[model samples]
Target: MARCGSKACWFGLGMALGAVVGGACAMLVRTATQERVLRQRDAPMVPSDATADQALTVDATDVVEYRGFVIHVFCHALGMGRFKALCDIWESGAVVLEGGGPPTTHVTAEESRSAAIAWARQWVQRNG
Candidate 1:
């Protein structure tokens, strides 16, 4: 039996206590990280034709030519419940107009894309 007053006995007790505390801390950290990952995984996801392994945030990016002006629109989910859209109008290889619509809690990226395109078309009609 180790004497309670011995340095070696106290050192061993300290080391054992440290190991137990360290192990408990590790378990807590691991559990917290797992819960965070699970929460993100369970969040609403953007549907796509692509495979699950190929996760894409930007669902639509397309270019359209109208009246010799090119309209470029890009759309993506802001938070899976909201969406954002940006647009550019180019003429003769120079960007003539650039803007973005306000983010909205829309369910689909297509809605944002169509709204951006409609805004661009209206601008072209008034200017062209």
Candidate 2:
């Protein structure tokens, strides 16, 4: 058998190591993301010890027109005075698409609304 000091040997070793490490990193990321989503989804929508005020200062949902489609955005409260967004895209009063963003909560309902609108705009550009 030949010696193990060739470039091919090192390349193979590097590739194998990279694959193992990459797989591990990807799994870790996926697990963490799932855990985060679960925690955020299951937690309280508002703080328990906070004063009795509305979670949102404005209406929870609104509809706007964009790119010849209707975009309905809803802001949902998260704990610690944060918010996330859910969106619905409609054409002819029937939904064409829908999505939600939870891991990206904002400090205000308006902010969440803006983020949802931006996301909807990009989605429209890409898929509509």
Candidate 3:
């Protein structure tokens, strides 16, 4: 112990410093990874302008008017078969069916243009 200026002392000090730096870097990387994953996975559940009290599903059928036009309204979640019926009615009746969506089918100009007009007018009056 008279003079402890050996190569072992320098190596030990360097090893300890390297371990501390590496541990800190690993922690930083882990935190950044977690944050990025959460940001990408956790999208907002509700619409931006919608309030907490707003209803999630609103059906247009409640106010739909089934007058002489035999009108049908296909909403956002309505299936393709129903949409097809609406399209058929449109093509056949050639009327003015109101409303459209991702796979929506509206009344065409064939079947009952007057009926479609009456249906739309009544629906808007009732719903709006």
- TM-score leader: 2
Candidate 2 clashes: the total is 0
Looking at candidate 1, what is the lDDT of residue 58?
Answer: 43
User: Local distance difference test, per candidate?
Assistant: 0.71, 0.76, 0.43
Give the alpha carbon lDDT tens digit for every residue of 16-124 in model 1. Answer: 9999999999999999999988886335455464343132244337788999999888765545356666788889999898764444434566777788788788888
Candidate 1 local lDDT, residue 97: 85
- RMSD, candidate 2, Å: 9.2
Q: Lowest summed-lDDT stretch of 10 residues in model 3?
A: 80-89
lDDT score at residue 3, model 1, on the 0-100 scale: 63
**C-alpha displacement of 45 in model 1, angstroms?**
12
lDDT of 2 by residue, 1-128 (tens): 64668899989988999999999999999999999888755365556755532544345477889888888887766666677788888887788886644348788778888888888888778878
Q: Comparing candidate 1 with candidate 2, which one achieves the higher lDDT?
A: 2
Best candidate according to lDDT:
2
On residues 8-118, what C-alpha lDDT tens digit does candidate 3 reach at each position? 987887899999999999999999999998875323244445542132133323233443434453222122222111211233365554452122233332222334345
Taking all chains together, the TM-score of candidate 1 against the true structure is 0.50
Q: Which portions of model 1 miss their true places by more than 4 Å?
A: 1-60, 102-105
